[model samples]
Each structure stands twice: as structure tokens, then as C-alpha cells.
Target: MTFKNTLEFAQKLDAEDKLARYREEFIFPQHNGENVIYFTGNSLGLQPKSAKRYVDEIMTDWANLAVEGHFYAEKPWWDYHDRFAQKLAKVVGAKPAEVTVMNTLTVNLHLLMASFYRPKGKRYKIICEEKAFPSDQYMISSQVRFHGYKPEDAIVEIKKREGEHNLRTEDILNKIEKVGSECALVLIGGVNYYTGQVLAMEEITKAGHKVGAFVGWDLAHAAGNIALKLHDWQVDFAAWCSYKYMNSGPGNASGCFINEKYHNLKDIPRFEGWWGHKKDERFLMKPEFKPEAGANAWQISNPPVLAMAPYLASLELFAEVGMPALIEKRNTIVAYLEFILQEIDKEVPGTFEIITPSRQEERGTQLSVFLHGQGKALFDYLMNHGVITDWREPNVIRLAPAPFYCSFEDMYNFGQILKKGIQDKS
Candidate 1:
């Protein structure tokens, strides 16, 4: 489909959009008198209007039921985390028993590593992407250090080909093969935070398994933005935060997936707490830790209910629209966004370049643009003019037109703003 940079063309596309009405479901921030063009969903999603109601319900339940709220509240605080299993499993493409909600993203990754990152003797190295999110880099390094190995020796980073903006699939697989017998684990961001590149997770997971490595994904940017089949991919484990595309509040609870094959493995070590004990036996205060039968076994404590309330609210939206519909709109809006960027780039020749992969499957809702002749001045201009985007260090601007709330008109308007910002600088 041809994309034209015009208000009428964009409005026409919006008018025909089946998901456009759902945009009203979100609450956007005002820039002057109009809603800002929100392109930072890869960092933080717009809040759902229903989030307040969800949080209020928990507040009301606590006020009325007091100590008995655990058993008597409408959602039953004792089993609040259980409510996420089915809804979240559908979102990430896993079985209900294979998924659970628990700590924040990094915390969950650390806990999961306690079980998946067993580095015995010769098989100690972990393969990850170069320039991974700082938190992941810290986590992997600390884990390696705890196991008595220097990060330089244990972490094998798959570097991008000299001048490339993204890691090639062949380079990643070759790195795994090179690590070979030394590769104990393979963990990569399912969607790269920097370049917005969606890695070939299934093929990478296969290759990792072939090399006797436990493969996992940090789905912080992938979970709600892409179509993931963690179970079918045979991913050993995975974790994702709910705040970004999931539209949960900032720093909210995380969703986790542990393959069913590992559910009953008693020998696998985990950092256990009462919440991970057998449900029926939890209140009994058993002397020994009897692990919950599925991913919940990784829970370190009872869930933070307030933190999870918004997540449940967002999952309801996911259930209503489903991922298939989201992906359909995502493909169109993102392509349209790319088109807008190209149109604008032509106007301001050689000023910017989209570092993100051109293929639909190789990218998500985000497009990371490499500003060539522009800098923070251009970013500041866009932000000051009602365009909310994410700016990385040096000169990259990450624009994520989240399909759920971002409209075609936003793409057109952003293009206009971008072109003007460049021309003004000149």
C-alpha cells in the first residue's frame, strides 16, 4: 500500500482503521492544547484509562475486608498473581502453567539465572548481544562474578559488523558456535533496545540448544510489541516488564515463562520464598520449601498487588484486541512511520538515517533513527513542539509509534515536525 504524507490521506487511513476507536482507551499527555505525538512507548506506554479503576478496586477491597482481603476480596489478594497466568500466557504465547507474574524485570532475570545459569567446569561462558541494555550488562557481569569468573572471560558479546547498526543473525549464530562447548547459557534481548531490531529468536534458540546452552530472552521490548512463541521456540526461560508496550505503570511487576519441561525438576536450584511454596501448604508454614508446580516456583515473595493492578488492566486490553490484531495494526503503522521518516529525510537530505531494519519481521513498533547532520537540537525541537520521542546518547532518536494508540495522522504530523526542525536548524 502506498503511503502519502498528507492530512487527508492519514485521516482517511484512520477513518478506515478498526482499531482506531481503541485509541480512546488510553489517556495521552497534552502538549499545549493538543495531545502530543507519543513515540516513546518502547520506553513507557501511555496509561490506560481503566488503570485507575483497577487500582481503586484493590484499594476498596483492602479498606472493606482488612486482613481477610487475602481470601475475601473480589480478586482474592492471596491469588492475585495467579490471575495473570492465563491472560499473560496468551500475550506471550505460552501455556498458563508455564507463565507467572513476579518481581521486576531485572530481579526476575537474576532469580531465573539462579536456576538456568549453571556454569560447570568447561561450559561457563554466556553469549549475549554487544551493548545490551545497561541493566542486563550489569546483571550478567555480576552473575558471572558471583560464580568466580571475570566478565571478560565468561561473557561472549556478539559484536555488530564494524559499521553496521544491528547484529546480523549469521554473526550471532556463528558466535554461539564459536563459544561451542564453553557456552553454558544464551540470553539476548528479544527486541534490541537500541536499534529496535527483532532478533531471530527461534533459530537462535535452536542453535543455542544444539551447543548445549540454556537459551532465554529479556522480552522487555518484545513481549507486547512482537508475536512471540516462547514455548514453540523451546526457550528455556524468559522475562519481561509490563510498563512499556504492556501499558502497566512504571516499574510494575514482571511476567515470566519457564518451560513446562523444567516445572518438576526438583534438582534445579532456585531462590525460594513462601510465595513459591505449594499453594495449599503456604499458610501451614511448612518447615521445608515445597515448590509450586510451575513458573510460580520462582516467586521470591508474595506479589505486590498495587504494582500488578495496572498490569491486569492492560492484560484485559490485550484479551479484548488480541495480539494478532495488534500486530496487524503494528505492521501498517510502523511501515507508515518508516514511510513518513523517508519522506522527511528526502526533504532534509543527508540529515538522518533509519538504523532500524527495513523488514517488518526484523523490527517492532520502534524505528531508531541515526541523525547524521543533526543532533540534540533537532530532538529538542521535536520535543518542544509536542512530539514525545526517546533520544539516545550522541545522536539517535527512537520513535516507537505504538499501534494501539498512535494514529496515521501522528506519522504525518511527526514527519512535518521533523522536516521543519531540520530546515529551522539549517
Candidate 2:
């Protein structure tokens, strides 16, 4: 498709967008009087318009039912988390039985590691990507320590080739093979939080399994951004937070995937609780621990219905507009954003460098731009000018043209703001 940098071209794309009608569904942040051109959905998604109604319903139910709300509420608190499983299973590409909504992201990560990260004898090393989100690093270090091993010895990070921003698929696969029998688990993010690089999850899963390592993904950035096939690809387990791409509000409950094979694996030691007890026997307060089948077996406590409400609202929108539509819109928006970026780069050489991959399949809608000789000043300029994007560490700006709520006009305006910022800085 031919590209142009004119406002008319941008407007034309917006006019033709099939998903344009969904833009009003989100409540964007305001700057001065106008809504900011939000490009931080990769960090925190905008609130869905129906979020209040969802939460209000729960509040009303609680007021009326009191303690009986567990079985009597609009959405029964007893089975509240179960409501998202079928929908979420579709999102992460898993069977309904294999997926469940549980605690927050890191909590689910720790829970999954507890069940899957059983370091035995010499086969105790774990592999992850370098520069993974800090929480993951801390979690891995703590887990290894709990298992009586030093992090430096038990954790093997797959690093990028010298000076490269993203780790190559072959490099990660080779690392798995090199670790071989000593590799007990391969846990990595589906998308690198900083670089916006989408890893080859299927290949990675296969490589780990080939070497007798349990494979899993931290899909915080990938869950709602890209199409995944966790079940089809035979991924052992995966977890993701909904606050970002899923627009489930800040620090919402997370979704988890456990391959059906583990549902019956009685040998695996798990951190169990009453919520995970067999549903029929849970109300009876049974002394014996009998876990429910599938991923629901991992639940620690009854889900917080009020907190899960916003997720239901966001997920309902996702169900209305399927992932295929979202993916199509994302591809075009990203292409336009990339086009504008290339033009800006040509106009002001060395001002910034795009670290995200150019290939559509290799990334989501996010593009992480590394400032050359500049710092947060340019980011501040964009923010002050009504462009709400995320900034990372020493010098990187992360912009995401979220498909569900963000518009083509927003991307166009973002490019315009970026161009002006460059011209002013130069």
C-alpha cells in the first residue's frame, strides 16, 4: 500500500478503518481540555467506557446479597473467575479447561514456578532473556535461592549478539541446547518489555521440551497484543496481566495457562488452597485436599469480583471485536506509524533510532525509539504537547498504537508531534 505523510491521508485511513467505531469505547487521558493522543497502551490501557457499569453492578449486588453474594450475586463470587476462562482461553490460545483468571501477574508467575520449576539434582538451571522485566529477575533469583542455588549459577540469560537490541531465535534455541540436561526450566517473556521484540514462542517451547526443560512464557506484553497458540504449540504454562493490552485497569487479576497434562499430574507439588478444592466439596469445608481439574486448580482464594469487573468489561469488548479485527487494524496503524517514523528519521538523522523490529510478525503495535543525543526532554515535549507515551530508563520512548481504542488520526498526530519535536530540538 502507498503511504503519504499528509493529514488527509491519515484521516482517510481513519475513515476506512473497520474498527474505528470502537474508538469511543475508551476514555483517554486529558491534557489541558483535550484528550491526549495516548500511545501508552503497552504500559497501561485506557479505561473502557463501560467499566463503571461493570463495577457498579458488582457493588449493587454486594449491597443486596451481603455474605450470600458468593452464590447469589449478579455474577456469583464463587465462580467469578471462571467467567473469564473461555474468553481468555481464546485470547491466549488455550482450552477453557487449561486457562483460569487468578492473582496478579507476578503472583501467578510465582505460583506457576512453584508448580513447574522443580529443580532436581544437576538439572536445575533455568534460561531467560537478558533485560527481562525486573520483577521477573527478582522472582527468578528468589526462586533459585529458595531451591538452594546461586542465581549466577542457576539462571542463564540469553543475551543479544554484540550491540544488538533483540536476542535472535537461533541464539535462544542454541542456548537451550547448550544448557541441555542441566536445563530444568525455560521461562522468558513472549515480548521483550523494553525492545518490543516478539519472540518465536513455538520454536522456543519446542527447543526447551527437546532438551527436557519445562517451557513457559510471561505474556504481560503479548497476551492481548498478538495472536498466540499456547495449547497448539504445546506450551507447558503461561501467565499474563490484563492491565496493559487487555484494558482491565491497573494491577488487575492475571490469566494463567497450564497444559491439560498437568491437571492430572499429582506428582507436581503446588501451593494449594480452599478455592482450588473440588467445587462440590469446597462449601462443605472438607479437610482433605482434592484439587479441581485444569488451571482452576491453582487458585489460592476466591477472586475479587469488584476488581475482576473491569476485566469483564474490557474482555467483553474483545469478544465483540475479535482478535482478527484487532490484529488487522494494528498492522495498518503500525505501518503508518513506521512510515511517519522513517520520514522523521530522514528529516532529522541521528535524533533517534527504532529498536523494535520492522517485520510485522516480529512485533506488536509498540515501537521503542532510542534517543541519540537527547534524553527525557523530547519525551516531555511530546507529553506537554498532548502525546501520552511511555519512557524507559536512560533513554527510550515506547509508543503503542493500541488497536481497540487508539485511532489512525492519533498515530498521524503522534507522528506530526514527533516531527515537530525533532525540528525544534534540532
Candidate 3:
């Protein structure tokens, strides 16, 4: 499909977009009395207007029902989290019994590691990508240290080829094979936060399992942006925050997946709490711990209703639109954005370099660009002019045209602004 940078063409595309009406559901930041061309959903998603209603309902229940809210409220506080099991399972491609909502992303990963990262004898090393998100690096290193092994010795990193910015699937598989019996766990980000590279999760999971290792993913960037098959792929466990493309508010509760195969294991190591005890017998308050049926067994405490309210609000929209429609719009909008960038680059040759892979399947909504002969000034200019984007180290700007809230006109408008910024800087 051909794309044009003209305003009229953009308007036509927007008029044809089925998801265009959904844009109004989001509250965009204002710039000069107009909505900003938001490109930072990969960082923090715009808040859904319905979020307030959801929160108000929770507050109302707390005020009216008081202590009885646990069982008497509209959405009973006791089983509040149960609402998310089916919804979240659909979002991440897992069975209802295999997924649950819980603590923040890092916290859930740590708890999951306790169950899956048991290193015995020669099978102690863990494999992960080089330059993973800082939180994951810290979590993996801390886990390694807690297990009485040095990170340098127990962690194997799959490095990108010298000049490449992305990891090849073959390279990842080769590392898994090379480590073989020594590998105990394979944990990686489903999408590289910086480059927006979508890893081959299914292949990686298979490779890790072949080497006798438990495999998992941190789906921080991948969850709502791309299609995933965690259950079909047999991933041991995975976790994702709801604030990114899912459009939940900042620092919201996380959703997790644990394969059904692990649900029946009685001896799995975990840091259990009262919330994870068998639901039927939870009120009995017995001395011995009996785990819940599925992924809910990993919960360390009761759900934070306030934090989860926004997430539930966002999931409603996701259910209405579904991932299929979202992916269709995502592919086109991102391609259009890429086209606009290419047009701007042609006008100011050598001024921009898109480091993200050109293949649609290899990336999601983000396009991380290397700004040549530009620095923070360009980023600052874009920000001031209402082109909300993300900036990383070494002169790179990440533009994520989130399909649910971003329209084709945003791509065209952003191109004009970008071209002017380049000329002004020159």
C-alpha cells in the first residue's frame, strides 16, 4: 500500500480508518489549545476517560459498603481480581486458568524466578539478551547472587553482532545450544524496549526447553503491541505491566501467565502468602498452605483495587476492539509513520536513521531513530512543539504511533513538524 505525506491524503486515510473513532476515547495532552501529536504510548499511555468512572465506583463501594465491601460491593473486593483472569488471558493469548493479575512487573518477575530459577549442580547458568532493560538486569543479577553464584559466571548474554542493533534468532538459538546442560533458565524481554525489536518468543521458548531450561519473557513492550501465544508456545511463565499500550494509568498492576503444566506441580518453590492459598479454604485460615489452582497461586497479597481499576477500564476497550483490529491499524499507522520519516529524511539527507527493523513482524508500534547531527535540542524542539516522543541515550528518539489513539493525520502532521525542526536547526 502506498503512503503520502500530504495533508489531504492523511485526511482520507483517517476517514477510512475503522479505529479512528476510538482516538476520542483518550485524553491527549494539549499544545497551543489543540491535542498534541502523541508518540509516547510506548513509554506511558494516554489515560482512558472511563478510568475516573472505574475509580469512582471503587471509592463509592468503599464509602457505602465499608467493611462489607469485600463481599457486598458491586464488584466484590474479595473476588475483584477474578474479573481480570479471563480478560487478561485473552489479551496475552493464554487460558483463563493460566493467567492472573498481581504485583508490579519487577515484583512479579522476582516471585516467578523463585519458582522457575532453581539451579542445581551443573545446570546453573541463565541466558538473556545483552543490554536488557535495567530493571531486568538488576533482577537477574540479584537472583543470580542470591543463589550463591556470581552474575559473571552464571549469566550468559546473547550479544548483537558488532555493528548490528538487533539480535538474530539464530544467534539466540546458538547461545542456548552452546550452553546446553549448564543452562537452568532463559529469561528475556519479548520486545527490546530501546530498539522496539520483537523477539521470536516461540522459537526461543522451544530452544530453551530443548536445553532443559525454564523459559519466560518480560512482556513490558510486547503485551499489547504485538500478538503473543504464551500458552500455545508453552512458555513457563511471563509478566507484563498494564500501563504501556494497554492504556492503564502509571504504575498499574501487572498481569502474568503460568503454563497449565506448572499448575499441578505440588513441590514448586514459591514465596507463598495468604492470597495464594486455596480460595475455598482461605477464610478457614488453616496453619498449612494450600495453593490456588492456577497463576493466582503466585499472588503474594490481595489485589490493590485502586490500581487495578484503571487496568480494568483499559481492558474493556481492548475487548471491544480486540487485538486483531488493533494489529491491523498498528501495521498501517506504523508503516505510514515510517513513510513520513523516510520522506523527511530524503529532504534532509543523512539527518535521520531508523534503527528499527523494516519488517512488520520484527517490530511493533515504535520506531527508534538515530538523529544524525542532532542532539537534545531536536528532541526538546519536538517536545515543545507538541510532538510527544521518547529520547534515549546517544541521540535517539523513539516514536511510537499507538494505533488505538494515534491517527494517520498525526503521522502527516508530525512529518511537517519534523521537517521544520530539521531546517530550523540547520
**What lDDT score belongs to each candidate, Candidate 1 first?**
0.94, 0.91, 0.93
TM-score of 3: 0.99
TM-score of 2: 0.99
At residue 419, what lDDT does model 2 achieve? 84
TM-score of each: 0.99, 0.99, 0.99
Q: What is candidate 2's lDDT per residue for 1-426, written digit by digit as tens? A: 898988898899989999998888989778888889989999889999999999998899889988888898878888988889788888888999999998899999999999889999999999999989999999999999999999999999999999888889999999999999999999999999999999999999999999999999999999899999999999999999999999999898899999998999878889999899998889899788999988989998988888999999999999888888899999999888888888888988888889999898899979999999778889999989999889899899998999988877787788888888878877
Mind giving the per-residue lDDT tens digits that candidate 3 earns over 1-426? Answer: 888889999999999999999998989999999999999999899999999999999899999999899999999988889998887888899999998998999999999999999999999999999999999999999999999999999999999998998999999999999999999999999999999999999999999999899999999999889999999999999999999999888988899999999998988899999999999999999999999999889887988998999999999999889999999999999999999999998899999899999998999999999988889899999999999999999889999999999989989999999999999999
* Candidate 3 residue runs with Cα over 4 Å from true position: none
Query: Model 1 reaches what TM-score against the true structure?
Result: 0.99
What lDDT tens digits, residue by residue, belong to model 1 across residues 1-426?
Answer: 988889999999999999999899999999999999999999999999999999999999999998898899999999999988888998898999999998899999999999999999999999999999999999999999999999999999999998889989999999999999999999999999999999999999999999999999999999999999999999999999999999998888888999999999979988999999999999999899999889988887888998899989989999989999999999999999888888887777899889999998899999999998778999999999999999998789999999899999999989998888999998
- Candidate 3 pairs with clashing backbones: none
Off by over 4 Å in 2: none
What 10-residue stretch in candidate 1 is worst by lDDT?
340-349
